[model samples]
Target: MKLDALGMAQSTLVFVVLGLTLLAFMWGRFRYDLVALAALLGSVMLGLVPAEAAFNGFGHPAVITVVAVLVLSRGFERAGVVDLIADQVLKVGERLLLQLTVLVGTVVVLSGVMNNVGALALLLPVAMRLSREHNTSPSLLLMPLAFGSLLGGLTTLIGTPPNIIISSYRGDVVGENFSMFSFFPVGASVALAGLLFIVLVGWRLTPHRAGQATAEDMFDTANYLVELRVDEEAKAKGLTLQQLQDELDETIPVLAVVRDDKRSAGYAFYDALQEGDILLLEAGPDELKVLEDKVGLSVVVTPEEDDDSSTIEKQPEHKKDGNNKDDDDSPARQVDTEGLQLVEAVVRTDSMMVNRSVRQLRLHHQFGLHLVAVARDGARLKQRLRDIRFQGGDVLLFQGGENEISESLATLGCLPLAKRELNLGQPRKLFFSMAIFALAIIAMLLDILPTAVALSTAALVSLLVGVLPLREAYQAIDGPVIVLLGTMIPVGQALETSGGAALIADTLLHFGSKWPIVMTLTGLFILSMVLSNVVNNAAAAVLMAPIAASLAEGFDASLDPFLMVVAVSASCAFLTPIGHQSNTLVLGPGGYRFGDFWKLGLPLSMVVMVVAIPMILWVWPL
Candidate 1:
């Protein structure tokens, strides 16, 4: 193909925009959305993408479907559907292989319908508990579970970002979008084969990490030891420790008793509690709040009252006085406490919090966060928490709203020590959420509506009927992902329009012309897979789709086979932890090293290639 001056310039500009986008994504300094927006604006400035059509990608059917799927995933989470299944995951036998089979299998099925990362998150704790119970290394379970989620995403249109992008590309090429189940024939075959390999042989390839500890060991609750004072009117004022334990659902062990200025040697489990007595307790941040509310206990803030405490003095008069004026009228007070969470975090060396105390930082007033407990290595600090200086590596337990806690941790330069457990909302809506989701899937399969429309309608119903709160529905949509798709879609179109895709395809075909069509397809699949591991999978798909279509056109072959290869291979990012979100999610919990992934991932990738190529060719023959 020959290109005129304008055509050549447009193609060159598109290539430059794409190259910079790839660099920004790989750089990891800026958020992906920002990088994509920069690329989009650059394209418009260069006349590659028209300014009038710049925002069209946001309204693209694929983007809408992704948004709807994310909202539905949140609805299912809030409805406790995943939790109900997770509860059953615990009942699977203690035998390592059996437990892994059940756990990985369940996650795979869930990932097929919801976000794969969410599926991994839902089952992570269950996997840890199973490991602790069976005395098996968590390393064996986490990686396989992560892999299973990735595998499951291949089976449906809404399963993964790459699949959605591929389907949208197909719609543009063929004039009709793929049905919800179109990916099923090839995806299911690949997933089943991959699952078998993971179960029978892939797991054995994982490195045996020694001294695998449970969550309790990793978090080290003993370091969070602090004292709570018993109020005169407290419900447990006269109760023995044993009696108190029976009354409360969660265990808050009394490690010692402080009477006057003297401390007891050990837990006084048989001793009766008394007013004004300080009970040294071992509990996480959330547990401390529950104990205070139930037993009328107060955190014994031991730091001397500072006369010039600006944070406290600057508070609103009503809040400063701690008076309950119109408690019934205050919606903040009426809000359910279920959303409140306790999390442990570690201060990094470069954290702004170093050398500052909680009182000085005014954490409670500024961020709505409370420092419930602090842990320092070597020895315990005897001073009050407010007086204790923060240092690098100090482990602190923070209590606050889940969202607030996450934001505050990031702002304060703290790394979370554990994964926050998913909050399965009120149990009443589980059936409703599931029924609505099923109906949407049915509508798509029956061709009653387009995939995006059916999903969007279902998401709207979920919000209207209160399956998911409005705030949560918005939060559920991954903003960066949406922006990446919206921005990259136009760039991809530019590649096609400027004939850059054809140019690249022709250049590659020159070397591959003599190779069999099957080999060419395999090479393209392998190329997409490799690129996916190094960059974002969605970006990989967006970039590869144009070239895949161009290659089919050049070879006079069916586009289905080529696009299928792109979809399947783009999701197979198994070579490294950075390749997929699921892999990174398990990195800390599994105690895995960067190099550890390829041990099992290498074989699994080989298996996927062997299985997927045959399946793709058979289902959508070239």
Candidate 2:
């Protein structure tokens, strides 16, 4: 293999891009997708890939493959396939561990046959609902469920992006194909073991900080105290405050009363309400508005101008004014004219500030959000100011200006916490949707249909059969990932075509020729794992697959073991969220520290390697 100066320059550019992306990931400068696009733009500037091929990855079969998988997953979701499973499996009366096991098991089983991230998306909301109902921290369940999804993807070729990339590379390397279940035994073993760990003690070990609060806590309604008018025609116009309370369930209290410009400070409970009398009450904004409407009353404009005041009354005529404007300066939008307001956000596990105190993140200095109270389960932090290490699922009660809440949460990889209150509006064509997907996978595995053809067919069927809206089915696929994957495929092909992989392989093998085949495979696995964490896993697979095959050739070993090693190792994205999509999704939800992964993931990766090696050797034999 030979490389001209241009080729070397291109390779150098690629390496530089990889280095910068790693630094950006560590620095939290931008999204991983954005970083990759930036690197691609850099490659074009350096003329690494010709202008024509710059956008080639967008059209690649692999890119199409990922999109098709996403659409298919959505089809299944719309068909109520996952919801059906949940209906039967997510029983409320089950033991905690049993419930987790059933939920995690279903997620794993489903993910093993589909995109793991897609599987997680379907189950996440269900888990949130379960957590609320069980009065437990979602944090305790989400991490284990997420890890289960990752493990489950190991079972099938199309389950995760890396596996598909590895199998495609196998065709390029040894002129062989990976069967749908070629790696199933080994992958399934590891998945089962990992799932057990998650069910038995993993969820239990997590901090159950989410105390007793319901999902409603995440959307804290603003409280307001206002006085209302009693119109002549209103039902409560001549009723006493105590009489009105008796009729309307008495949840609201009439705090004060005023009539004929005279104020009464004593409890207004027994005071009679006249047409012009004022009744002061405390309630949330929505509640107050509803009460005003129901009572045919107008809001008191000022503290002194109660219902009894002789002033311009009745609902004011609609007019264009600064008050009606939606801009930040508008008083209507002002929760805190003092520049402080309350908000709620979920803590992500991978946040750099996770496991750190509010003082450590310097909440006010860095993000301008003051920690008001931290809620876990339904329980509020007893000592909010002094003791609290943010963990995943701990909902923070925040005091900050509008939009600062979102900005601050983004920095922590957290999100404005949301709960799934399902209103199953309609049931789509479930049977047809499931039939199409099942047939597609079967056809692909039977060699009667190519995977791309099968999946694309399934996606189309979903639209035609009314399982997914035509607009929405297409919308489910990520455009940037499609572009990145499609564009990079040809570049990777050019690398292999030019013997760049062979050249790299020769150098590695030359230095370790005396090493046994197992050791050689292990070395390649380690290299693949490291590269996948820093760069895109699919890109890492493209770069390393051919090298792994070349190494097998040098050692006179079966290419199957080497290919499987590349597949498994590339998917073991344990070190960083940037390594995998599932990891990134959990970053904000788990409230995990960036450094926290290596604690659990590093050990899991080792277990995968140790378990996979023997299985690969036994099943595929070197």
Candidate 3:
């Protein structure tokens, strides 16, 4: 095959862009999304990819399917499906191996139908809790759970983005796409083997880090000392301090009591409760919120109230003042606290709020956030929370809408602490979420609709029915992953159009002609696995699918084995945190360093290759 000058130039440009992308991805200096976008722009500028088609990847079916799957995952999470399952699983005893089997296996199964990252997210808190209860390091459970989620994606077409991309490429080449369960035989075989390995041996290889710390300790909530006032309508008004403590489940301790400005220090257990009495309490933000809701107590306003209101209590009246001035006939819009959350954030040295007080920042008036508590190390804050100046290391607990809280935290340069599972545990819309997801899966398996359309429709229905709020639904979709996919798709096409993929395949066949076909398949699998670890799996699949097809055609063999190899290998990105989103998701929570993944991942990857090669050959017959 003679290469034309234009073809050679295009191929060279494509390879150059791909090489730089790989370097950028490995360097970790820039985010993957930025790297991909720069590569796409480079391709367009070099005339390797058309400018008009540069952004077409964002609208691709694979991208759409991923987005839909994310939205659906959020729906399942918000509906408390994982909590419902955790309750049942927690009853099965605390045996480490058995717990590992069940928790890892559940995430694997869940990954077959939903996004793997979402599956990991749902089970992560459960795994942490189990770790605490069983007195085990989370490192033993987290890596296994992350690997299980990746392996589970191998079983179904929509289980992971790479599978969907490979299936779509197959449709373009062979005129018929693989079915939803087309990957089941080989995928399930590999996933089950990997799961067993993790259950039996892989976790044993994990590094033992400090993983038994409770969420409170992880967030450093020991210094939070807040005061609440007993309201006239409060149930605690008539109860003694000890009775109030007992009613609160004894989780929080009442430190002191101030009645009519006379302070009674040290465990006011025998003090009688009275209206307008201030109770100094030692509790975290979550406990404080729960106490307020249960007893109808209000946060005590600080004595040094500046001209500006400095407490949550005064904000409503302050807003009402505006309403009264604007129109006496107009009713004020009440703040919606239905889905409000209590989040802990620590002010960074570079934070905009580093030297500002809550009163100076006007957090509540400007951002709908009310400062509930603030904790500073080495010294107890005795003044009003709003008047307390926030230093670099100050941890502040803010209460507001979940979305607003997240945005405010970012805007103020504060890092959120460990996320708390604050679900009502009722699974309010569990049946609705499950039914919709089931219908979508059934429709895909039955070929009633395209995979993208079915999942997208289910996502839309989930939003319309309020299974997940609109804001959360949008947040569910990972923006960087989408951009990486959208940008890389066109680049993959450019490689194929320039005959670069064919050249790579011809080189592989040239060398593999003397070897067995299984060796060739194994080579492809290993190469894809390496690429997946170094870059995004979707990008690996997109780049390798054409090469796999070309090799099959060159050798005059079946395409099934080649594509199957690509699918299995692409999902086996266990070598690095950046290789797969699931791994990255667990890195911080699992207390894993960058080098920590390979402790167990290297062995697991070998296991995948050993188990997957024969399974693919037997199932698809090269």
Candidate 4:
């Protein structure tokens, strides 16, 4: 059939550029955003995308909605909304199967309403704490939780960037976007099936690395942290760390004594433990269980299999105060007026802290941060927090204000291990935060406002109502993702406007000429899923939405089913950690190898495809 196509020269150039761009993304060499930016510039420079419209993608509805969702997710976090839910997940008892069910279920629900990555980050610390409390390895919970986030994101329009992109693409092509809940039927159905597999069977496929890996894998700490609970009438109440060691005769190293929220690290050996003090021990899972059986002391933290030895107590470095050169400053001396926040961070290889003691740097006096604990390598650090010399890969716990901790960590060349828990200084407006988010969803459902406008209004209201601070709202937007979306959108437009997408659709149609229409739909779904695994899902959606539209036109079929298929498949990035941010976030903490994801991910992927295609056809119709 005679059809419109770009000039051969232009189409070839577009093909060459896109081919290189995909290669760059798969190589994983440069950041995806940088690669997208390069593609946009190349298209503009080659006159494929008009120079005037090169940056229009930044203002795309999809990008705005993505940013708004991220901010709103942060607002929910700051308001203590999800944390309250996490408290319930913690109370679900100690059974691994039961724990996986509740934890994955909670994440799935949360992800449908918020950014999936943010939902995972909010629950990650809780998962770590749960492992310590249950005496199991984090590996069993983390991968499932990450996968749950991806599954959950498939269930709603704002749940993931790909959904938003798909919906917006419909508006550009068909003169109207899919309604907010249009995806709910197919998406929610597929999510339930995927989650069923994850909680029931997929978690078993994950590696159990609690005792096999370093403490750094759990919380990026130096040693396994087991909390020793001291009861009022407990036999170990008045005993010192040294006395306990002597009594046990096995020399278990104590890392710190926690009273209330105060932590005493590098404390004197003769200092007696109080009735309610929680002692942080450096022992692993096997020894912790053994200690419980041997002594009357109950283990507060969960056990991981380890019998590792730790070094104890270093001498504190004395640094002179500026006001009085003869007076030494204390690391724990003056608490900041803004309030204290406990933060976990990992020192970078190039940190100025390397080989430097906290006492020497006067961390509290200089940066308003107090070093609470430090762990190096896989070994226990015996030295006190103040006396210990910092090393690369050392995990540090610090006490500082919300803003101060962030700035201080950056200055010290440290990366935070978890999302900052609500800043103590900030207010938690749970009612306002939830109400705002709900109203935004309501507006979109009622068609009173579009998705982008509603979400942007909700985010703005969240900022104004103190649900999330202005500074944090800015931080909530993922920079690389925003850049990638902004750049890729224009290039995607170039692909369609230049007839490149139609050309690809023609080839796909030719290949399926003798096949059933259902087979053609499956081919598009699989293509989108595989591309998403190797690149950003947003990019996958950006590239595939036009192709889906072209294919729909070529087959004289309804575009809704084709667009719906693209939306679902673009989010089925379960095969690799690089496919989605949720997977990458858990990799280090879960101690997961690159290939570990597919162990669970492969079966889970099959489950999604099995469920999604039929559901999409039924819900959207061919």
Q: Which regions of candidate 3 deviate over 4 angstroms? A: 1-8, 215-428
Query: Model 1 off-target regions past 4 Å?
Result: 1-8, 219-367, 370-428
lDDT of 3 at 450: 90
- Using TM-score as the yardstick, the better of models 2 and 4 is 4
- For each candidate, what TM-score against the reference? 0.73, 0.68, 0.71, 0.72
**Higher-ranked by TM-score: 1 or 4:** 1
Superposed by TM-score, candidate 1 places the C-alpha of residue 403 at a distance from the truth, in angstroms, of 12
lDDT of each: 0.76, 0.65, 0.75, 0.75
lDDT of 2 at 612: 83
lDDT winner between 1 and 2, please give it. 1
Superposed Cα RMSD, model 4:
12.7
- Expressed as tens digits, the lDDT of each residue in 262-364 for candidate 4 is 7765233357777878776545444555566655666542233232322111101111111222222222122121222456665643356767887577675
lDDT of 1 by residue, 58-137 (tens): 99898999999989998988898888887778888878788878988998899899888667756876787787777788
Candidate 4: deviation at residue 589, Å? 0.7
Best by TM-score: 1
Model 2 residue 426 distance off true place after TM-score fit, in angstroms: 6.9
Roughly what TM-score does model 1 have, to 2 decimal places?
Answer: 0.73
TM-score of 2: 0.68
lDDT of 3: 0.75
| TM-score: model 4 vs. ground truth | 0.72
Model 3's C-alpha root-mean-square deviation from the true structure amounts to 13.4
